[model samples]
Target: MKLISLLFIILLRFDGTTASLVKESSDKNTVYVCGSGKGKRYHLNENCRGLKSCSAKTIKTTREQAQKEGKTLCGWED
Candidate 1:
C-alpha cells in the first residue's frame, strides 16, 4: 500500500513536470518554413524578407520538425 501511494505521488509529479514542459514547448514550437525551396532556413515570421525569395509554398511547422528536416533559423530572424 505504501509503495502504491509513493508511485502515485511520483506519477503526479512527473505528469505536472511533463505538462509544464509541453506548455513551454508548444509556445515556441510553431515556425514557418519554405516548402520545396533551395533555402534550408526556418523563419519566425511569415513576412520575413528572407521568405520573399522563396520559390515554393510557405509552410508552418514545428521548430523541432524543421530542424529534423535539416533546417536552421533564418539569418534574418531575431
Candidate 2:
C-alpha cells in the first residue's frame, strides 16, 4: 500500500539521521572528572593539574553529558 511505502521511507530517513548522530558523537574526544569535587567540574585532560590531588575515583564522560549535569571546565584546562 502507499502508506506502507511512505512508512518505509520515513524509517530509512530516521535510520540515516540516527547513524549520522552516532558518528558525530563518537568523533568527539572524551572528557574526565575528579570525583573528589562537587561534580560541577570537568576536564579535557585526565592529567590536568586541577586533578592532581583528586582523592576519589576519576570518571570518564562525554562533554555533552557533563554540560547537562552542570559541570564546568576546569580552570587549569580553561
Estimate, for each residue in 1-78, the C-alpha lDDT of model 2 and write its tens digit: 999988866676579875554544465667888776576788876667887778899987888988888888988777
| Leading candidate by lDDT | 1
Model 1: runs farther than 4 Å from truth?
A: 1-26
Clashes of each: 0, 0
- Report the Cα lDDT for candidate 1: 0.80
lDDT string, candidate 1, 1-78, tens digits: 999988866676579875554544457878889887566899877778989988889998899999998989999886
- Candidate 2 stretches with Cα past 4 Å from truth are 1-28
The local distance difference test score of each candidate is: 0.80, 0.76
RMSD of each: 10.0, 10.9
Error of 1 at 14 (Å): 39
